[model samples]
Target: MKILFVCLGNICRSPVLEAVLRAHAEKAGLDWEIASCGTGDWHLGHGADPRSRASAQRRGYSLAAHRARQLCAADFRRYDWLLAADRSNLAEIVRRRPADATARVALALAHAGLPQPLDVPDPYYGNAEGFEAVVDLAEAIARAIVARDAE
Candidate 1:
């Protein structure tokens, strides 16, 4: 299974989700391929935000080598799933997805069993606490994905 996580910018939410989900999949012995990208091109080729990297490190996940990339039409054909961090990103992804693409696109939290999907908030302008919150959400989402796949 190949999964691609998306957000407005690759520097924060999407990259964090990529790292968290990859860790969970690896620990579960799943052979899933995971990656992340942003709808915008602003941070392309740049590493994740400093605060995001620091917050992830505190939770034992590394964002040390994560580089931001912009989402492209080809990604829809490459990944099995495209998981958006928030509703806005999800909408944009759907709008931009190729007509013949085979990827399933949805909010990352959709399978978490929540009554309603929750958007993974952008923490770029906030302090460490915001990033910490993102970690909490990312862990939950990762576990949910792993559990669902196991079933």
Candidate 2:
């Protein structure tokens, strides 16, 4: 399965989801292709935010090699799933999806059976605690994705 995570900026939430889910996918022996992108292009080509990287690191997850990229039309055709961090981003993705696209786009948090269609709060302008919260959410969503793939 191919999965893409999307956020306003690729530096925080989406990268965390990609890293966390990739680890879960690997451990489950699932050959899932996982990547992340942003709705905005501001952070294109930059690595994940240091705070996000550190939060993932604390949990033994790595965002070291993650580079920010903006979502494009081609991605709608390339991935099986496009998981958005928040409602606005999801709406933007839906608006940009090609007519012939096959990707299933939705909020990443919902896949985890969390609050129905909840937005994984953006941690970019907050403190370390915010990033930590994102890690927690990412881990849960990763496990959920693996479980779904297993089924």
Reference-based lDDT, residue 11, model 1: 96
Candidate 1 lDDT over residue span 1-151, tens digit each: 9999999989999999999999999999999999999999998899999999999999899999999999999999999999999999999999998889999998888855543538988888888898998898999999988988966
> Which candidate ranks first by lDDT, i.e. highest?
2
What C-alpha root-mean-square deviation, in Å, does candidate 2 show against the real structure?
A: 1.1
For 1-151, candidate 2 gives per-residue lDDT tens digits of 9999999989999999999999998999998899999999999999999999999999999999999999999998999999999999999998998899989998898866776539999988899999999999998898887887778
Per-structure clash totals for the candidates? 0, 0
In candidate 2, the residue pairs with backbone N, CA or C atoms under 3 Å apart (3 or more residues apart, or in different chains) clash, namely none
Error of 2 at 99 (Å): 1.1
Give the TM-score (vs. native) of candidate 1. 0.96
